[model samples]
Target: MYAPRSPPPSPTSRQLAIIRFGLARIVPIDDEAPFAEIAAAAGLGEVHVRRLIRHAISQHVFQEPRPGVATHSAAPRLIAEDADLAAWVRWRADDCWIAAYHACEAVARWPGSEEPNETGFAVANPTSLTMFDFLATQPERASRFAAGMRLYAAHSDLDLQYLVKAWSWGELPKGATVVDVGGSHGEAAIALARAYPSLSFVPADVGGRIRYMIHDFFTEQPVHGADVYLYRACFHDWSHRYAVRMLQALIPALKAGARVILNDVVVPGPEEMSPGLAAGVRTGDLGMMILFNAGDSEMAEWARLFEAASSGFHFKGGKGHRAQGCGFWRQSGRDIVHS
Candidate 1:
């Protein structure tokens, strides 16, 4: 006789409301703006925010005291502490992404451009510089952007901890030097150094960002000594050609036998084939596409890109080299030997 299967757990109303409040950060929500006030601020009827808050309350994403007031609770705590979410919010809510969202409509009208046809938005409203470019002009927004990124970093730290702990680094050769190519503030590098005291980590990024990391984390003096490098999610922002060029820059510093560790999503197989996994992969791909006009890549694609960079350079498998559930590779001749 087969045993009965357990039913899926149901979310509490309070939990759902809290989640809605977090999402509200993406939309517009303010303590000064109650449900009706928020609706007015959004230029909608007062009942709209009320209806939304009621539905969210059912989901437990926010807490509603009495009839229409909504406030923060435990549900939004995760989002509050998340760095990527903060970055996304700052990007999306900024005038640039908002303008781009409006501009997306123009794609159908005009089609030709020397650059990639995918504009952040396609509709014709007002042509302006990029959000980051605009932020450069407005230093205050840039500061806000930095603050948002820090919030996102808090959440990312947990995930980084998991990845670092799961991937063994003790096997790396003594005096192994790591370069975090685009590490924002050396958080990942610090974690790795703490875990493996012998390895040295160097967190690298563009000038301004790197300066911030030096000020914030390295204030107590350099922690990783000189072995490991924590790049975080920098190289993935560029095309494979540029990524290889970035790697080439590090060859002089990279000790022979030192490994490059990339912490990013590896796109999975087709959608109909692996529904759940495909959904996640596709979502990540779309995120990269929308945000940076980039997409998630397959392991084979990564291997090919790495092999193309140098003649003898290939994936050396040991610890911290496994590609999650995917296969591994080694460079041999012009071919990438996968196992």
Candidate 2:
């Protein structure tokens, strides 16, 4: 009979620091190199490099077959393959980890503050600037953050094809206009345009997109009467108060038959999900709390948000309602009221 093994202990801060140093320095030059050679490449002493490598070996990040040789394992190999993945690791080690360190003090001082600027990130940086503003001043850090987001999108199930396959976009009339709000880089719009040639897309990011309307959801929307308004993974970054305002901004522009589609996680109740699934969402919730005092909403909260936005709005059918959840809300027309 086979015996079950216990899970490995979490890596120590020193271990993580060593991992970051090695990832930034050693991995790029050679996946497998002598300890002395790696030390020379990284401008560190051989003894210290061996110690860090041994600790990393314990975590399966790298391998040491003999006393003097170091080689990349699956984890380090994967990181070496993608520059963005490496940037993500560095960002986590540098930025996110620093913010997390100050989270307790931030919570104690703020005492339920809803402002994003009052976050742990803000507390750690010793600036009145929001994390976004702070990152703007640090271009390299900002570049890493952007690269990390791209890595996240590339690895996660949140790919554009997932949205295209899940939603019934073909149901709409040919030449129907779809407005992608806050559509950074127009990734989703471009993907959808390629898949459904019949549909017209206006991505509200970057210049020179045909008839691109600069609509900020915080204020009133500029593009009115579009067949569909698409908001993908946008709402979870804000508190309910801001989320309500964002939704309300759409009300003025939304014509009778207009559909507002939100592609975001609809967090399930604790009892409704497996422990692993629950942990995944709750982990995201904690990150949101630390970063922006925001959270993933449950289905009831989503329904309430729409109702609070306006009585004329109603929740409608949606595919891909479970994994990487999406929801559809329709604006009620006078003649064909949906209540």
Candidate 3:
């Protein structure tokens, strides 16, 4: 005989704005302030702050401590850890993205130069500042950015470890090499090497970042035959024209039948086609678009690039292959093999 509870209302645009404002202030969820204190800090009226917090909590961005107090929740925590999320939010709030939003107004007034790059503020407002560039200009932002990446890496590492463990490594030769392309700080390499003691790993990145790996190489080289190579993420941040150049750079060093791993997202189909999977893929794709205007490849795209490489190497069937929606190919001398 008890009355049924009503469903919470969906979030409104105004509520979303307030939530974003709150997120910029409160990071590292473990440290949170009282509602009144946060409201005053944000310069919003107490009633308005309360209403905004209430709405945010319902949307799972903020968690209410009691009736009036709230703290950051999983959604914001996930967002904080994501570099792309940070970049997207910054872009959306930035003058550049804001101007892009109003680009239609200018187009309506003058019909010429309709291309996004020509009219959109993202291109016109050339800050020449990448997220890393911003970090260089604003040291504090860099610290926050590093902290966010660490959080993301920690979470991602866990998932990667699980995948590594779940997949059968029988396909690999007894002493085969596993090269981790764009490996950051050697964490992924260390994890995989530790899990599969028999396998050798080479952690590759840019020259500056590789210095730390050089020290590790000298100390642990004999033990694991570990080597570090330097290549820039800058190439990956560009179009296929530059991405092909980046891939070509690896040709001289690659060994036949060696596993070359590209640890990046494989974009999914349209959102309407597969809601949950598409959401995850597009989330990553958008992040790439916002942060560097970089294009992350789909499986087919990866295969094409692999075929075009000097070695003409293709990715063979590997762990999480089907789930990732990626294709496989192989290389023999200059001939490319696709599956």
Candidate 4:
């Protein structure tokens, strides 16, 4: 009888590290390279490089064509061709991997902190600054985060087309300005500007109807009386209390008829989706907790958050209830939360 195949090993931090190490060392090569040459490129000894590569091979990340050479296998080859894929893996492996291990410790230390500075990421990295501030100081890493997040947004139902149609942009009066709060790289702003042509950041490429400026979300909203202030996939990065502050910060700018829209994840109900999709949302919630001590919330939790932030806000119902997970909320006489 044929021998039974062994099941693949469960993934661990070391396995992820091996995948990253192998990719960092191997994907840049045009073809298979000698182990020593690869090691030289990475400034590591050949024996160490070979050992890591061998482990990565078992994970189907890289390949050893002969006894001494390394090349990209199916997984690593895909990673080589796709910048988004590379960024996704690179960010998770380089940033999140360390933070995940300290999550329990962070929970024990901070319990229920609303401060971003008390996150597992803060514990693992030992920095005084919060994750976003730290990323701002690291240009290269920030760029990677932005790129990886583009891929993430696409996957997480944060598409530009989906967002555009979520609300009735056409109903708004012409020359209406929509502030894309926390709009990293301004992809959504750019998308909206194109569709409306009467609307208007990161590269200063936006002008006329759109303008680019650096403003902290924690600060009071700068562009007051705008028709809409949209926060896309932004609030989940903050703790419940911090998220409240984010909403509170916008209060001074909100006109009576102005809208604050949220395009983010609404923690899926147990019966609302299949187990697989539900698990995905739950995993995301866990990720938020690990990195920022924040998370996705249920509908009532969202309503309560609004109530806690300010009594001015109330659920105007999800205008985009069918937009997959990109449900949009419209709150009258105050702010909106769209998930």
Model 1 score (lDDT): 0.49
Using TM-score as the measure, name the better of candidate 1 and candidate 4.
Answer: 4
Candidate 4 ranges with C-alpha deviation above 4 Å: 1-30, 45-47, 82-84, 137-140, 153-156, 197-207, 319-339
- After TM-score superposition, the amount by which residue 127's alpha carbon in candidate 3 deviates from its true location, in angstroms, is 0.7
TM-score against native, each model: 0.57, 0.83, 0.56, 0.80
Q: Any idea what lDDT model 3 has?
A: 0.49
- List the candidates ranked by TM-score, beginning with the highest: 2, 4, 1, 3
Please give the CA lDDT of all the candidate structures: 0.49, 0.73, 0.49, 0.72
- lDDT (10s digit) by residue, model 3, range 125-229: 444444445447766445555655555444432355543554444355665555555566666556666666666665543322222233321122221322222
Candidate 2 lDDT score at position 251: 80
The weakest ten consecutive residues by lDDT in model 4 span 326-335
Best candidate (score: TM-score): 2
lDDT of 2 by residue, 1-339 (tens): 999987753464544565466543465435568888888887888898878778778877788867888877777777667677777777877788888889899999999888888888899887787777889899988988998898777744566766777667889898888888888778888878878878888864223333455666798888877888888888888988888899888788888878877777677677877766777777778888888878888777777778777898877634344434422111111111122
